[model samples]
Target: MSSADQSHPSGNKPLGKRARQKIERPRAILAAALDEFMLKGFWAARVEDIAAKVGITKGTVYFYFDTKEKLFAETIRSFSPNLASESEPIDKNRPVREQLTTYLAVLYEAVAINPDAKRVFHLLISEGRHFPELLDQYFAEFLAPALDRITSLITSGIERGELKSTGLASSPEVLIGPAIVANLWGIVFADRHPRDIDAILTTSLDLFFRGLLE
Candidate 1:
Protein backbone atom coordinates (compact mmCIF):
# COMPACT_ATOMS: atom_id res chain seq x y z
CA MET A 1 0.00 0.00 0.00
CA SER A 2 1.22 3.48 -0.83
CA SER A 3 1.89 5.87 2.08
CA ALA A 4 -0.83 8.27 0.85
CA ASP A 5 -3.46 5.49 0.68
CA GLN A 6 -2.50 4.06 4.09
CA SER A 7 -4.22 6.79 6.08
CA HIS A 8 -7.38 7.06 4.00
CA PRO A 9 -10.40 8.34 5.93
CA SER A 10 -12.59 5.48 4.71
CA GLY A 11 -10.34 3.08 6.66
CA ASN A 12 -9.83 0.82 3.65
CA LYS A 13 -6.16 0.15 2.96
CA PRO A 14 -4.92 -0.11 -0.62
CA LEU A 15 -5.57 -3.51 -2.17
CA GLY A 16 -3.08 -4.78 -4.77
CA LYS A 17 -5.35 -7.58 -5.95
CA ARG A 18 -8.22 -5.45 -7.26
CA ALA A 19 -8.62 -2.45 -9.56
CA ARG A 20 -10.63 -0.03 -7.39
CA GLN A 21 -10.22 2.76 -9.95
CA LYS A 22 -12.81 1.03 -12.10
CA ILE A 23 -15.32 1.40 -9.27
CA GLU A 24 -14.27 5.01 -8.65
CA ARG A 25 -14.76 6.05 -12.27
CA PRO A 26 -18.56 6.03 -12.10
CA ARG A 27 -18.51 8.09 -8.90
CA ALA A 28 -16.13 10.53 -10.62
CA ILE A 29 -18.50 10.72 -13.56
CA LEU A 30 -21.46 11.49 -11.28
CA ALA A 31 -19.50 14.15 -9.39
CA ALA A 32 -18.58 15.78 -12.69
CA ALA A 33 -22.16 15.56 -13.92
CA LEU A 34 -23.49 17.25 -10.74
CA ASP A 35 -21.14 20.20 -11.20
CA GLU A 36 -22.15 20.60 -14.85
CA PHE A 37 -25.87 20.24 -14.16
CA MET A 38 -25.80 22.75 -11.31
CA LEU A 39 -23.79 25.27 -13.33
CA LYS A 40 -25.83 25.04 -16.49
CA GLY A 41 -29.40 23.83 -15.86
CA PHE A 42 -30.20 20.28 -16.88
CA TRP A 43 -31.47 21.17 -20.35
CA ALA A 44 -28.39 23.26 -21.13
CA ALA A 45 -25.98 20.71 -19.62
CA ARG A 46 -24.32 18.47 -22.17
CA VAL A 47 -23.02 14.96 -21.65
CA GLU A 48 -19.87 15.96 -23.51
CA ASP A 49 -19.10 18.64 -20.94
CA ILE A 50 -19.74 16.22 -18.08
CA ALA A 51 -17.43 13.64 -19.63
CA ALA A 52 -14.83 16.30 -20.36
CA LYS A 53 -14.98 17.45 -16.76
CA VAL A 54 -13.88 14.00 -15.62
CA GLY A 55 -11.41 13.44 -18.52
CA ILE A 56 -13.67 10.74 -19.92
CA THR A 57 -15.40 10.42 -23.30
CA LYS A 58 -19.09 11.21 -23.88
CA GLY A 59 -19.64 7.57 -24.85
CA THR A 60 -18.23 6.53 -21.46
CA VAL A 61 -20.68 8.82 -19.71
CA TYR A 62 -23.52 7.23 -21.69
CA PHE A 63 -22.22 3.82 -20.71
CA TYR A 64 -23.00 4.64 -17.08
CA PHE A 65 -26.16 6.69 -17.62
CA ASP A 66 -28.16 6.09 -20.77
CA THR A 67 -29.11 9.75 -21.24
CA LYS A 68 -28.53 13.29 -20.00
CA GLU A 69 -31.92 13.35 -18.26
CA LYS A 70 -31.16 10.19 -16.31
CA LEU A 71 -27.74 11.56 -15.41
CA PHE A 72 -29.29 14.76 -14.11
CA ALA A 73 -31.90 12.88 -12.10
CA GLU A 74 -29.34 10.51 -10.60
CA THR A 75 -27.00 13.36 -9.72
CA ILE A 76 -29.68 15.03 -7.63
CA ARG A 77 -30.78 11.74 -6.11
CA SER A 78 -27.21 11.01 -5.10
CA PHE A 79 -27.11 14.10 -2.86
CA SER A 80 -30.44 13.58 -1.09
CA PRO A 81 -30.48 11.67 2.21
CA ASN A 82 -32.76 8.72 2.64
CA LEU A 83 -35.26 10.35 5.03
CA ALA A 84 -36.53 6.94 6.16
CA SER A 85 -33.10 5.97 7.42
CA GLU A 86 -32.43 9.47 8.72
CA SER A 87 -35.58 9.28 10.87
CA GLU A 88 -34.41 6.08 12.52
CA PRO A 89 -33.04 8.13 15.40
CA ILE A 90 -36.56 8.86 16.58
CA ASP A 91 -37.05 7.36 20.04
CA LYS A 92 -40.51 6.10 20.88
CA ASN A 93 -39.47 5.98 24.53
CA ARG A 94 -38.94 9.72 24.75
CA PRO A 95 -41.52 12.50 24.87
CA VAL A 96 -43.05 12.85 21.42
CA ARG A 97 -42.33 16.56 21.27
CA GLU A 98 -38.72 15.98 22.24
CA GLN A 99 -38.42 13.26 19.64
CA LEU A 100 -39.78 15.63 17.00
CA THR A 101 -37.45 18.47 18.04
CA THR A 102 -34.40 16.24 17.76
CA TYR A 103 -35.56 14.92 14.40
CA LEU A 104 -36.07 18.41 12.91
CA ALA A 105 -32.75 19.60 14.28
CA VAL A 106 -30.87 16.84 12.49
CA LEU A 107 -32.87 17.33 9.31
CA TYR A 108 -32.49 21.11 9.25
CA GLU A 109 -28.79 20.86 9.97
CA ALA A 110 -28.38 18.61 6.96
CA VAL A 111 -30.38 20.90 4.66
CA ALA A 112 -28.73 24.13 5.80
CA ILE A 113 -25.15 22.93 5.56
CA ASN A 114 -25.22 21.22 2.18
CA PRO A 115 -25.21 24.12 -0.27
CA ASP A 116 -24.69 21.92 -3.32
CA ALA A 117 -27.70 19.77 -2.43
CA LYS A 118 -29.75 22.94 -1.88
CA ARG A 119 -28.77 24.14 -5.36
CA VAL A 120 -29.96 20.82 -6.76
CA PHE A 121 -33.28 21.38 -4.99
CA HIS A 122 -33.54 24.79 -6.65
CA LEU A 123 -32.95 23.04 -9.96
CA LEU A 124 -35.78 20.65 -9.12
CA ILE A 125 -38.22 23.47 -8.36
CA SER A 126 -37.27 25.47 -11.45
CA GLU A 127 -36.98 22.68 -13.98
CA GLY A 128 -39.70 20.40 -12.68
CA ARG A 129 -42.30 22.31 -14.66
CA HIS A 130 -40.83 21.08 -17.91
CA PHE A 131 -39.54 17.67 -16.82
CA PRO A 132 -42.34 15.72 -15.22
CA GLU A 133 -40.23 12.58 -15.03
CA LEU A 134 -37.63 14.17 -12.78
CA LEU A 135 -40.41 15.53 -10.60
CA ASP A 136 -41.93 12.07 -10.24
CA GLN A 137 -38.63 10.49 -9.29
CA TYR A 138 -37.86 13.22 -6.75
CA PHE A 139 -41.28 12.91 -5.11
CA ALA A 140 -40.99 9.15 -4.94
CA GLU A 141 -37.44 9.13 -3.61
CA PHE A 142 -37.20 12.14 -1.24
CA LEU A 143 -40.52 13.83 -0.59
CA ALA A 144 -42.70 10.79 0.02
CA PRO A 145 -40.28 9.29 2.53
CA ALA A 146 -39.93 12.54 4.45
CA LEU A 147 -43.68 13.06 4.55
CA ASP A 148 -44.31 9.49 5.58
CA ARG A 149 -41.87 9.75 8.47
CA ILE A 150 -43.34 13.06 9.59
CA THR A 151 -46.83 11.60 9.39
CA SER A 152 -45.78 8.69 11.57
CA LEU A 153 -44.32 11.04 14.17
CA ILE A 154 -47.35 13.32 14.19
CA THR A 155 -49.72 10.39 14.39
CA SER A 156 -47.86 9.10 17.40
CA GLY A 157 -47.92 12.55 19.01
CA ILE A 158 -51.68 12.82 18.48
CA GLU A 159 -52.36 9.37 19.86
CA ARG A 160 -50.38 10.24 22.99
CA GLY A 161 -52.24 13.55 23.42
CA GLU A 162 -49.01 15.49 23.14
CA LEU A 163 -50.28 17.50 20.20
CA LYS A 164 -53.55 19.19 19.29
CA SER A 165 -56.03 17.77 16.82
CA THR A 166 -55.26 19.85 13.73
CA GLY A 167 -54.08 19.79 10.15
CA LEU A 168 -50.59 18.84 11.29
CA ALA A 169 -52.22 15.63 12.48
CA SER A 170 -53.24 14.74 8.93
CA SER A 171 -50.80 16.82 6.88
CA PRO A 172 -47.33 17.01 8.43
CA GLU A 173 -46.28 19.54 5.82
CA VAL A 174 -47.03 22.17 8.46
CA LEU A 175 -44.02 20.91 10.40
CA ILE A 176 -41.59 20.99 7.49
CA GLY A 177 -43.08 24.05 5.79
CA PRO A 178 -40.32 26.25 7.15
CA ALA A 179 -37.67 24.05 5.61
CA ILE A 180 -39.04 24.79 2.15
CA VAL A 181 -39.18 28.47 2.95
CA ALA A 182 -35.68 28.38 4.37
CA ASN A 183 -34.36 26.87 1.14
CA LEU A 184 -35.85 29.80 -0.74
CA TRP A 185 -34.39 32.16 1.84
CA GLY A 186 -30.94 30.73 1.30
CA ILE A 187 -31.26 30.88 -2.45
CA VAL A 188 -32.07 34.59 -2.37
CA PHE A 189 -30.21 35.98 0.64
CA ALA A 190 -27.39 33.52 1.09
CA ASP A 191 -24.88 35.97 -0.37
CA ARG A 192 -26.12 39.27 1.03
CA HIS A 193 -28.24 38.60 4.11
CA PRO A 194 -27.38 35.16 5.30
CA ARG A 195 -29.04 34.26 8.58
CA ASP A 196 -27.60 31.96 11.20
CA ILE A 197 -29.14 28.65 10.13
CA ASP A 198 -29.01 27.18 13.62
CA ALA A 199 -30.82 30.16 15.06
CA ILE A 200 -33.48 30.07 12.40
CA LEU A 201 -34.10 26.38 12.85
CA THR A 202 -34.23 26.59 16.62
CA THR A 203 -36.69 29.46 16.60
CA SER A 204 -38.85 27.81 13.93
CA LEU A 205 -39.10 24.56 15.84
CA ASP A 206 -39.66 26.34 19.14
CA LEU A 207 -42.59 28.17 17.65
CA PHE A 208 -43.80 25.07 15.80
CA PHE A 209 -43.97 23.00 18.96
CA ARG A 210 -45.52 25.77 21.07
CA GLY A 211 -48.41 26.11 18.64
CA LEU A 212 -48.90 22.38 18.15
CA LEU A 213 -48.38 21.20 21.72
CA GLU A 214 -51.39 20.96 24.02
Candidate 2:
Protein backbone atom coordinates (compact mmCIF):
# COMPACT_ATOMS: atom_id res chain seq x y z
CA MET A 1 0.00 0.00 0.00
CA SER A 2 1.06 3.58 -0.53
CA SER A 3 2.16 5.55 2.49
CA ALA A 4 -1.22 7.26 2.29
CA ASP A 5 -2.90 3.87 2.78
CA GLN A 6 -1.53 3.46 6.28
CA SER A 7 -3.75 3.91 9.36
CA HIS A 8 -3.27 6.22 12.31
CA PRO A 9 -4.98 6.48 15.66
CA SER A 10 -5.77 10.12 14.92
CA GLY A 11 -9.44 10.58 14.10
CA ASN A 12 -10.63 10.95 10.56
CA LYS A 13 -11.08 14.46 9.11
CA PRO A 14 -12.03 14.05 5.46
CA LEU A 15 -8.68 12.37 4.72
CA GLY A 16 -8.51 8.60 4.90
CA LYS A 17 -6.48 7.02 7.69
CA ARG A 18 -3.50 6.57 5.38
CA ALA A 19 -3.94 9.96 3.76
CA ARG A 20 -4.04 11.67 7.16
CA GLN A 21 -0.91 9.84 8.11
CA LYS A 22 0.74 10.93 4.91
CA ILE A 23 -0.32 14.52 5.52
CA GLU A 24 0.91 14.54 9.08
CA ARG A 25 4.15 12.64 8.46
CA PRO A 26 5.77 15.35 6.36
CA ARG A 27 4.82 18.05 8.85
CA ALA A 28 6.45 16.03 11.61
CA ILE A 29 9.44 15.41 9.39
CA LEU A 30 9.74 19.05 8.44
CA ALA A 31 9.52 20.19 12.05
CA ALA A 32 12.32 17.83 13.02
CA ALA A 33 14.20 18.53 9.82
CA LEU A 34 14.14 22.28 10.48
CA ASP A 35 15.63 21.79 13.91
CA GLU A 36 18.36 19.57 12.49
CA PHE A 37 19.00 21.75 9.45
CA MET A 38 19.25 24.89 11.57
CA LEU A 39 21.65 23.10 13.89
CA LYS A 40 23.77 21.37 11.23
CA GLY A 41 23.16 23.35 8.06
CA PHE A 42 22.20 22.26 4.54
CA TRP A 43 25.46 20.77 3.31
CA ALA A 44 26.17 18.84 6.50
CA ALA A 45 22.60 17.72 7.28
CA ARG A 46 21.91 14.12 6.26
CA VAL A 47 18.61 12.44 5.51
CA GLU A 48 19.55 9.70 7.97
CA ASP A 49 20.07 12.32 10.64
CA ILE A 50 16.68 13.89 9.95
CA ALA A 51 15.04 10.47 9.88
CA ALA A 52 16.49 9.61 13.25
CA LYS A 53 15.40 12.93 14.59
CA VAL A 54 11.87 12.25 13.35
CA GLY A 55 12.00 8.54 14.27
CA ILE A 56 11.55 7.54 10.67
CA THR A 57 13.64 5.55 8.23
CA LYS A 58 15.87 7.18 5.61
CA GLY A 59 13.66 5.72 2.87
CA THR A 60 10.66 7.40 4.43
CA VAL A 61 12.40 10.75 4.37
CA TYR A 62 13.11 10.30 0.69
CA PHE A 63 9.50 9.31 0.11
CA TYR A 64 8.34 12.68 1.44
CA PHE A 65 10.94 15.09 -0.01
CA ASP A 66 12.71 13.07 -2.71
CA THR A 67 16.05 14.77 -1.96
CA LYS A 68 17.94 16.74 0.66
CA GLU A 69 17.80 19.76 -1.63
CA LYS A 70 14.03 19.61 -1.72
CA LEU A 71 13.88 19.30 2.06
CA PHE A 72 16.12 22.32 2.57
CA ALA A 73 14.11 24.22 0.01
CA GLU A 74 10.96 23.52 1.97
CA THR A 75 12.70 24.52 5.19
CA ILE A 76 13.68 27.86 3.67
CA ARG A 77 10.17 28.30 2.37
CA SER A 78 8.89 27.89 5.91
CA PHE A 79 11.09 30.65 7.30
CA SER A 80 9.89 33.01 4.60
CA PRO A 81 6.41 33.52 6.02
CA ASN A 82 7.95 34.99 9.14
CA LEU A 83 9.50 37.68 6.99
CA ALA A 84 6.80 38.03 4.34
CA SER A 85 3.89 38.37 6.74
CA GLU A 86 5.39 41.62 7.95
CA SER A 87 4.55 43.23 4.66
CA GLU A 88 0.83 42.72 4.84
CA PRO A 89 -1.12 45.70 3.63
CA ILE A 90 -1.66 48.50 6.08
CA ASP A 91 -4.53 50.94 5.99
CA LYS A 92 -3.61 53.45 3.33
CA ASN A 93 -5.48 56.19 5.14
CA ARG A 94 -3.34 55.81 8.21
CA PRO A 95 -0.50 58.25 8.76
CA VAL A 96 2.55 57.30 6.69
CA ARG A 97 4.89 57.13 9.66
CA GLU A 98 2.45 54.94 11.57
CA GLN A 99 2.22 52.53 8.66
CA LEU A 100 5.99 52.41 8.28
CA THR A 101 6.44 51.95 12.01
CA THR A 102 3.99 49.04 12.01
CA TYR A 103 5.83 47.39 9.17
CA LEU A 104 9.21 47.63 10.90
CA ALA A 105 7.77 46.38 14.18
CA VAL A 106 6.29 43.33 12.49
CA LEU A 107 9.62 42.59 10.83
CA TYR A 108 11.45 42.95 14.14
CA GLU A 109 9.00 40.74 16.00
CA ALA A 110 9.24 38.00 13.39
CA VAL A 111 13.03 37.93 13.57
CA ALA A 112 13.10 38.15 17.35
CA ILE A 113 10.74 35.24 17.85
CA ASN A 114 12.31 32.99 15.20
CA PRO A 115 16.03 33.42 15.62
CA ASP A 116 16.82 29.90 14.45
CA ALA A 117 14.67 30.36 11.41
CA LYS A 118 16.46 33.62 10.73
CA ARG A 119 19.83 31.90 11.10
CA VAL A 120 18.79 29.24 8.64
CA PHE A 121 17.70 31.99 6.29
CA HIS A 122 21.06 33.72 6.57
CA LEU A 123 22.83 30.45 5.88
CA LEU A 124 20.79 29.92 2.76
CA ILE A 125 21.63 33.40 1.54
CA SER A 126 25.35 33.00 2.21
CA GLU A 127 25.81 29.41 1.11
CA GLY A 128 23.33 29.08 -1.70
CA ARG A 129 25.98 28.83 -4.44
CA HIS A 130 24.90 25.45 -5.76
CA PHE A 131 21.24 26.18 -5.15
CA PRO A 132 20.57 29.30 -7.13
CA GLU A 133 17.21 27.94 -8.13
CA LEU A 134 16.17 27.57 -4.50
CA LEU A 135 17.30 31.07 -3.69
CA ASP A 136 15.47 32.37 -6.74
CA GLN A 137 12.32 30.63 -5.63
CA TYR A 138 12.62 32.11 -2.16
CA PHE A 139 12.99 35.64 -3.49
CA ALA A 140 10.26 35.27 -6.08
CA GLU A 141 7.75 33.73 -3.73
CA PHE A 142 8.39 35.73 -0.57
CA LEU A 143 10.66 38.73 -0.82
CA ALA A 144 9.43 40.12 -4.13
CA PRO A 145 5.82 40.29 -3.08
CA ALA A 146 6.74 41.95 0.18
CA LEU A 147 8.91 44.48 -1.60
CA ASP A 148 6.21 45.15 -4.15
CA ARG A 149 3.71 45.92 -1.42
CA ILE A 150 6.11 48.25 0.32
CA THR A 151 6.88 49.98 -2.94
CA SER A 152 3.22 50.41 -3.59
CA LEU A 153 2.81 52.00 -0.19
CA ILE A 154 5.63 54.42 -0.90
CA THR A 155 4.12 55.30 -4.24
CA SER A 156 0.78 55.91 -2.61
CA GLY A 157 2.35 58.07 0.04
CA ILE A 158 3.97 60.23 -2.63
CA GLU A 159 0.82 60.50 -4.68
CA ARG A 160 -1.18 61.54 -1.65
CA GLY A 161 1.37 64.21 -0.79
CA GLU A 162 2.03 62.47 2.47
CA LEU A 163 5.64 62.17 1.35
CA LYS A 164 7.99 64.59 -0.36
CA SER A 165 7.93 64.95 -4.11
CA THR A 166 11.36 63.48 -4.45
CA GLY A 167 11.94 61.65 -7.70
CA LEU A 168 13.11 58.61 -5.73
CA ALA A 169 11.19 55.74 -7.28
CA SER A 170 12.60 53.08 -5.00
CA SER A 171 11.57 54.83 -1.84
CA PRO A 172 10.67 51.68 0.00
CA GLU A 173 14.19 50.34 -0.46
CA VAL A 174 15.61 53.61 0.71
CA LEU A 175 13.45 53.53 3.81
CA ILE A 176 13.53 49.85 4.71
CA GLY A 177 16.86 48.49 3.49
CA PRO A 178 19.03 50.05 6.20
CA ALA A 179 16.66 48.95 8.95
CA ILE A 180 16.73 45.37 7.66
CA VAL A 181 20.52 45.41 7.56
CA ALA A 182 20.68 46.81 11.07
CA ASN A 183 18.26 44.20 12.41
CA LEU A 184 20.27 41.40 10.81
CA TRP A 185 23.52 42.75 12.20
CA GLY A 186 22.03 43.20 15.63
CA ILE A 187 20.71 39.65 15.68
CA VAL A 188 23.89 38.06 14.37
CA PHE A 189 26.48 40.10 16.25
CA ALA A 190 25.06 41.92 19.26
CA ASP A 191 25.28 38.99 21.67
CA ARG A 192 21.61 39.57 22.38
CA HIS A 193 22.22 42.96 23.85
CA PRO A 194 19.16 44.94 24.83
CA ARG A 195 18.49 46.95 21.74
CA ASP A 196 15.91 49.66 22.13
CA ILE A 197 14.05 48.54 19.04
CA ASP A 198 11.38 51.18 19.45
CA ALA A 199 13.97 53.95 19.58
CA ILE A 200 15.76 52.63 16.55
CA LEU A 201 12.55 52.30 14.56
CA THR A 202 11.38 55.74 15.61
CA THR A 203 14.70 57.25 14.66
CA SER A 204 14.61 55.58 11.27
CA LEU A 205 11.07 56.73 10.62
CA ASP A 206 11.95 60.21 11.71
CA LEU A 207 14.87 60.37 9.34
CA PHE A 208 12.82 59.04 6.44
CA PHE A 209 9.97 61.35 7.25
CA ARG A 210 12.26 64.36 7.37
CA GLY A 211 13.62 63.55 3.94
CA LEU A 212 10.16 63.07 2.54
CA LEU A 213 8.60 66.17 4.09
CA GLU A 214 7.98 69.36 2.13
lDDT of 2 by residue, 1-214 (tens): 6655555556443457666767778988888888777667777878898999878899999998988988888777766544544565668669865776677556544443356555555666566887898778767875576567667666777788887666444744565555566556765666766576557766776776687775
* C-alpha RMSD (angstroms) for model 2: 5.3
lDDT of 2: 0.68
Model 2 ranges with Cα > 4 A deviation: 1-20, 82-92, 108-113, 190-199
Model 2 residue 5 CA deviation in Å: 21
Q: How well does candidate 2 score on lDDT at residue 164?
A: 65
Compute the lDDT for candidate 1.
0.75
- Alpha-carbon local distance difference test for all models: 0.75, 0.68
Worst lDDT 10-window in candidate 1: 1-10
Cα RMSD, each candidate? 3.6, 5.3
Query: Per-residue lDDT for 1-214 in model 1, tens only?
Result: 5533643346675634235555677889888877887778878888998899899899998998898877877787787655665757557688888777777766665455567667777778877787788778878877777777777787888888888766776777777777777887888798999887667777889887778874
User: Which residue pairs clash in candidate 2?
Assistant: 4-18
